[model samples]
Target: MTDILPLAQLGRRIMVTGPTNAGKSTLTVALADKLGVPAYHVDLFRHLPHTDWEPRPTEDFHALHAAAIAEPEWVMDGNYSEILPQRLARATGIVVVDAPLLSRYVRYFKRTLQRQRVGALEGGKDSIKWDMIHWLWHTRGTAEAHRKLASETGLPAVFCRDQRDVAALCAAWDLRLSLS
Candidate 1:
């Protein structure tokens, strides 16, 4: 008899949630690349046109997510509380990436710098300002709250405390698939 692998049994829908600059998008992209599935950034649905900070219609967000979930396989990344229930219902797995406040701050700063320097962000405009960074750190309380809610949801969640943990989880997933 041979042992079977767990990842071989994984379902298609997945959600990646985390604090700001915790690398949720990076993780989603990596997973999608590995799994050969589509990955959706919820921010793209939430952001309004020509405005970096302005939000789109909440109903539109819900509808967009609903449509995405209709797909057979997808990796959704974001921390939109209003759509949590719908996402949770459709997600086969949840990955929560967490890091210290200082670490998140550093990551956000570096990402902003990189995006600004590369002129790759929306509208070919750099929206990250010192005040925005300050506001991000100040408003981190919301991410913490979402983390708690996710924890309480009792989903089959993998919480990564830092980058090492994230790497380990990815390695484990790969190993399990290879063994299978």
Candidate 2:
């Protein structure tokens, strides 16, 4: 039997992990607002703000990620797997967004074509790239790894498998979309 935990049960330090364009950031913000905790977007720590998807130095990004996890309460969004162990150690629960690959591709292209995307780095421009298309193609199987990690750590996990699942969860939690 599948166990689907309620949003409130995810606790204060929730880790929202998923492939790019899978709505992880949006869910993180909603969870944070519902829980009255800070929301952290891992992309912000990994990339320099106000730039065209430029990455920060590896050490600098690691430092920022460490600091964010050290916070007492937060809902973090992203799947930086290299440093995932440390984050998982501090996380109380996990939310894994497993939207369909077609949906992900559509979201990626739509965001890139739009003037301003919700999760794009502040002041960073969104653009379509062959590399990103390749990345999207390889996003498969990531949600399973995320779920396995949560299981190993004995942390409960909630999975949003599609837009309908997301909507149901949000409604059940009484969560309001901040910016959608």
Candidate 3:
């Protein structure tokens, strides 16, 4: 899954995806800030206002996302699941930030309490749902699922074990490129 690290060219369109609260947004923002690329958190256009997250219309959300990635450079993070194929076609690189289930659970709550200021979609409230939390672990990809993701993307995706792996990649970005 090292395909995500820059090779001959710096990626112009990058997709960051993982189970919920796996630091997808954090990494996307860091890369976007350093690379001067537009970053879109899929949840921003996905969830409804406040605590009720019924999600926006699929067609409308996909259209908006399509427009965002149509730019010369962009970073987007989320595991929309349904539209991954469409996203993969446009993604020059992909980062899959997978963390331990325990870690995710810990973060799930930390962020929940911080929701008043730091959690959830920027404009949306930090609403908690039992099912969503369950899905975070229960529905997350396994080894086979990950392999499928790699196959589907048809591109090497950098597999990050956790947040530290992400930070290391960002800090050693130039070194990785030189090796490539």
Candidate 4:
């Protein structure tokens, strides 16, 4: 099947996965709005809210992730590979946002400069860090892994190769985005 799936082909439980700064959260919110479902971010479950990006306990994160997936209809974003299998099993469809590594780096830098964004950690400040820069570089190939996972799982998936593709998909799906 083609990677660009029609809106009708997508089911209620949609999973959005991508590398850092790839706009997964933005698309997730947009999809949830279009589908009239709740939106969940894996990051929100991974880290404690109203904190300085501190991580929740591993067990706590797992519990939150599991509970969120148990919900019937939702758009969940993020690719915590450790819990991917569980999420994938519950997800009805997938959207993989893949952009060039350079673009991702640029976006990461730009996002850090912004005070607020769709995927920002709650009450956590955004700042440039060597670890994050290294992460963006190291996980450059995550998009391919996400695509392979979708194919192996036989889930209907829509792939966005760049910002242009994401824009086109949003347009085709008639998604009204809150943040550009």
Candidate 5:
């Protein structure tokens, strides 16, 4: 939380990274809600029309992300490799949302099932398929890779390993803003 204060005070662009179902979207939305700034969910930019998992063109993805981060205040959420350099370049901070592997897998399963039952997914996309569940599990390694990348990118980052840390971070962020 202390690590986040400076970035929030500065109103810097940020990228929230984490494993699937680790609450990256939740945290990004919360931050944007608190700061009253725009938050871009990269999934919105990535997912193609009428397709479940097909990604958009690389050029289009970069253009879209470039446009989003061009703004003064924004928090972007995703782990698209093609956009990482530009994202890291513009990011004032990074928050890595990490939870235990077992916990994350359970969350992933529950979320996928919930989405399927509701016929809704992120970005108004259709419910995810069973194959997507396998993809989510594979994403576990990507989260670790991003943690390393964030460390090397030199952005001020806060890694929350569990729900307690997440709550603590939110509470501290609230306190900081109140005192400010």
Candidate 6:
């Protein structure tokens, strides 16, 4: 696996994957800022307003994703497994932000609370459904998924095993944010 920081410099199209609250958004935004690239967040499209995750139609989602990936330089972060191959085929670099399940639990709570303090989805309320946790529990650390992401992308892999891994990359690249 390669260090992620260098990938930011080399990759014109980047894909970042991880369970929610693993700093996927933060990294995507920061990398976009530093590199003067565009960040396409899948969640912003996956989730529809006020209907509780009423997913956009599959074709619609793919269309939107494809348009962004068609761009010569862009970054996207999310684990939309159904469209993994589409993303992988277009990715110039791939990153997986991994952490212990316990750590993910803690971060989820913290992030949920922070969202509550501020606001929820711009068009929806804060929702931390039991089903969401269940989904995370089942999906969070699937080795098969990671292997497939790496194998299909053919881009070198960068795995951030903990917060420190992300932090080190930020520091090394002189990024303005801290993983903390």
- Alpha carbon lDDT at 140, candidate 3: 59
Candidate 5 lDDT over residue span 1-180, tens digit each: 234454454346878888766777777877787777897888767766555557788788778888998888887777777778888888888888877677777765666555431112345445546776787677766766767877897767877777677778888776221110
lDDT of 2 by residue, 65-166 (tens): 999999999999988878888999999998888788888888778777875455678888767889889998887657677667666787888877777888
User: Per-residue alpha-carbon lDDT of model 3 for 22-134, expressed as tens digits?
Assistant: 77777777767767778788887676556456688888888877787677788788877777777778888777777777777777777666663222554565656798788
Candidate 5 local Cα displacement, residue 84, angstroms: 0.4
lDDT for each residue of candidate 1 in 24-63, tens digit (9 for 90 to 100): 7777777776788997888777776456556778888778
Clashing pairs in 5: none
Put down candidate 6 lDDT per residue, 1-180, tens digits, no spaces: 244446544478878787766677777877777778997788766766565456778788878888888899987888777877788788888777777777877766776655532112455655567876787688776644674666565676677777788778777767665342
Candidate no. 4 TM-score: 0.94
- List the candidates' TM-scores in order: 0.77, 0.92, 0.81, 0.94, 0.79, 0.84
Supply candidate 1's per-residue lDDT for 69.
Answer: 80
Error of 3 at 20 (Å): 1.6
Q: Report lDDT (CA) for all predictions.
A: 0.68, 0.82, 0.68, 0.85, 0.70, 0.70
In TM-score terms, candidate 2 sits at 0.92
Error of 3 at 59 (Å): 2.4
Supply candidate 5's per-residue lDDT for 77: 79
Candidate 5 regions with alpha-carbon error over 4 angstroms: 1-10, 49-54, 116-125, 175-180
Which should have the higher TM-score, number 2 or number 4? 4
> Count of backbone clashes for each model?
0, 0, 1, 0, 0, 0
* Cα RMSD, each candidate: 6.0, 1.7, 4.9, 1.6, 4.9, 3.0
**Model 4: per-residue Cα lDDT over 88-118, one tens digit each:** 8998998889888998888777767866578
Number of clashes found in candidate 6? 0
